[model samples]
Target chain A: MKRLPVNRLSSRTSSAIIWIVLLTLPLWMRAVGSYTELGTQVVVLALAAMALNFLLGFTGTLSFGHAAYFGLGAYGAAMTIKYLVPSTPLAILVGMAAGTIAAMIIGALIVKLRGVYFAMVTIAFGQVFYFITFRWNTVTGGDDGLSGWHRIPLNLGFTTIDIEHDGKAFYYFVLLCFALSVGVMAFLLRSPFGRTLLAIRENERRARFLGIPIERHLWLSFVISCLFASVAGALYALLNNFTDPRALYWGQSGNFVIMAVLGGMRSFWGPLIGAAIFVVLQDYVSSHTENWMSFVGLFFVLVVLFFPRGVLGIIRRRTMR
Target chain B: MTQLILFNVFNGLIVGAFYALMALGLSLILNLSGVINFAHGGFLAIGGYLAYALIPFVGFWGALLIAPFLTAFLGLIVERLLIRRVYGRDPLYSLLLTFGLAYIFEDSTRFIWGAQSVPFQVPDWLMQPLSSDYFFLTGYRLFMVLLVGAAVAGLFLILTRSRLGIRIRAGTLDLETVSVLGVNVRILRTLNFGLGIYLAGLAGVLAAGMLGLSPTIGTSLIMPSFVAIIVGGLGSLPGTLLGGLLIGVASGITTVFAPSATEAIIYVMMGLVLLIRPRGLLGEEGRVQ
Candidate 1:
């Protein structure tokens, strides 16, 4: 149900168009008066929204505190590079591990709950990390945020890629990660385990009747979703060479949820499209006015009222006709 | 040391009262409407700012009495226009709607009032310490406690005794039957949302007197109220009230020993309550899953 494999022909064609636009984005972005970094940012945030959709769209879990893990990923990566090692890849691993581990613990606590109660508990749990980061200023740099740490170059034993100095190389690097992450997610969504998740989403009572071990599957989905989000978080820290407590705040979580929803949470590529629009709009808005937040808020209200089905969802409906 | 502890305990109680007040309002909307009301803090800010604006024209006492009603009026309109459309839909839309509303409220407040903290004056007599020995006892603090107590009592009485209150309680339990029984469910929900916003507005004015008026003031209190609701028990008003006070006291007690853990301790309490009673202390049994 994630997609109509029945519509495989059309999906393949559209996916081809998607890849073509993304792969050559760096080349044409200048013509559009945008930089490669913005492209990379869209890719990175798209990855995050997609990860959130893994749980939210597929499993029907409404988690509202994913930013905690994302922030954990960011802080973990930043800390590793600043204090222990300057290796970029290792830092990403450490960040992912930190976030995923925490998710495992917290996911267990929330798996039994359904719907809004689950959402509320996740939100409450998220603040624990936020408070820790905000209060542990000595180690975390507190409110000033973690800075002075930079993304290091990648040495593949054959050649050294200067990620720090070359913007194009870094953009390619992030795009590569995005491709790999989405590929894995797509593959999983097509698998048997994935169908089980779909079952739970469609009808939890029926899924339980089939002995799908509902809570266990949910925990796995939660952990997987978080792992992907944390990876995006690491990339985000690399993108900026800075991490702040704001990364873990619940507001950031809301942004991710909106991205997924606005993109068409039911579709695989919906979040990516949503992320692109959101990132570009946000970049444009913040630069133009101090009241950018209100504008963004207005966007949300309008979307909820008018475009709740999202761009992809509407497109699908039109195509079906 | 005794004086210091006592002062903090009392201080915690005041803070707890604020949490209880806000949480009670939030709970009302959540139970009946199924909207998380993320913009709640935004409405709270509106209430505080409304009072601030009114104080210049009407004086503090008048603003205190009038601001919440004004805020609730705004809330009723918002519910009628915006929130009503999303009723019977997924909770996600309402949450996102309110989240956006929160952003508007915070930014608008900052834009209008200037982002800096604004002084909201109380009367001189209320500011005076009652006695040298119990110097922390100010008339204003006492007044806040008494007003909150009355409000809480009034709320409980309205639910149990009044016709509208009983209707609201019945609606919360089952909306279909209530609607089938000839109760206008639409008006009921609108009124209920107003009641919730009214509580938020009242909390705002009281909070402004102690914390001063700031765009972020409502946000700062919103989480504690959330924690209070969870720790007390979901769908239970008295539980929310107790949760607020309990967490307030817990944080207050923590401040005496490990000052930094005050905020963290509340979450810790939430975790403990979850572990021991997954649905919360006073949460109804069926609500657990």
Candidate 2:
């Protein structure tokens, strides 16, 4: 009957508290009926942002063109359902696979460059992808994007759930997927591979000298990040029921960078918070003013100048103190 | 076919001049401040809009002369207030900060100018076309090419022979070491930034005549300018010129031949160059490697 160590107990209790709180809130919000779609949007974006955090926070790599992977996932999922299979699970798998392949190819060449050159090369590659989508009018439907896409259908042999018919149900489906992805990411981060990534980010030359395969780690991180982004993209397409070429645009890629920075780059949960704040602010401000772009710009400037380490960083410092 | 090629060449030369002016400014600022100055495009946009505003009062030539100076003054203020704080920090921080500034500048321009395309008229004197039996070129375009050539030559002389230019170059090569030797490094950095902005403004003015003044013009031009810099090798003046003309010619010719793949052509060129020489065509070995 000896008392468990305080640190272990505190950690276990905190995780229990977090899960209990998260589990109840969705149910409580569902009772209120207003949080369904908003909750789903948050979940999807948070998932995407978390994927981005893997690269930005853990690996110290800033990608200016991650939307290419996101768009690839969305397009891949949609195309699979349209052409080969209408099964939701298969489509998602196809989307993730496509994203992984694309990332492996691009990341191999790009990971060699460092700093701003790396960022610009990614941007350039994104533009190349954008141009391909725009030019391949028959496949992608060009700039207009492909619509009339079907939703992911759940077929459990005996029961079927059409996701598009119920927003709350679809929200739950996405939330569940997000939870799985987050769990996977958390596990990966806690693994030895994740420790190696952190080590490489801290001192790449030192890591290389210590017998770490630096390039392989970077490529793996890039591919894994891309896979997560693609999953988010696939879910986003399923939620929206449409896919457009704009998804692959450089501006879209820039948005991910903005989101990553807006959330504290130093913390795991920062990008999720960043995405939530960004999406909410954009929706609110654009509704009120035609000059939303200017307002967003002003906000961005203030964020860079005053809160350089971002909101989470500020919070962490204060909490630590 | 010959006429089309000639037209594209002429167009490329004129566009290349604007590219050179913009890239020259960017290179100078990069050398002096060790920052990419992503807001360089915003300064160009301001010059175009300012020229657009001044077109009615002082006419195009007068506006051309005055607008860039005004934009340079704005650049000076930006450097003093925002850029100076993050001078010795990580390069990524500066890049992100300038990117944010670029967004602010771009959106502010849209808010002020109402997001519509502003018509920029070439002066009546220079509106005529230079024609031969086989090919024709616009008089204004030809003028722009000559003007940019003279400006390049003037800049070269100033940097190589003039006392101020020598100090600026000395400051660029080794900022702290030169500062310890009693040179005013901060002032030189400010001047370099101002000159860079001035060149951007000049490009904007020229662009107003060719592409017409618009808020979206900066967004469109920024990528091409970046492509020129990357292809020519960063921080090299001559490289900027070579990169700009190469891109301009390639883009123009590609548009003429394969309209659908025009946007793709720049990236294809960048990829080919990166494959062969990752540091760029004229980039110093191990400079950006």
**Model 2 pairs whose backbones collide:** none
Instruction: Give each model's whole-structure lDDT.
Output: 0.92, 0.80
* Residue-wise C-alpha lDDT for candidate 2, range A58-95, written one tens digit per residue: 99887877888888888888888888887888888888
Candidate 1 lDDT over residue span B22-87, tens digit each: 999999999988888888898999999999999989999999999999999999999999989888
Give stretches of model 1 more than 4 Å off: A1-6
DockQ for each model: 0.78, 0.50
For TM-score, the strongest prediction is 1
- The TM-score of candidate 2 is 0.92
Give the Å error, residue B11, model 2.
2.5
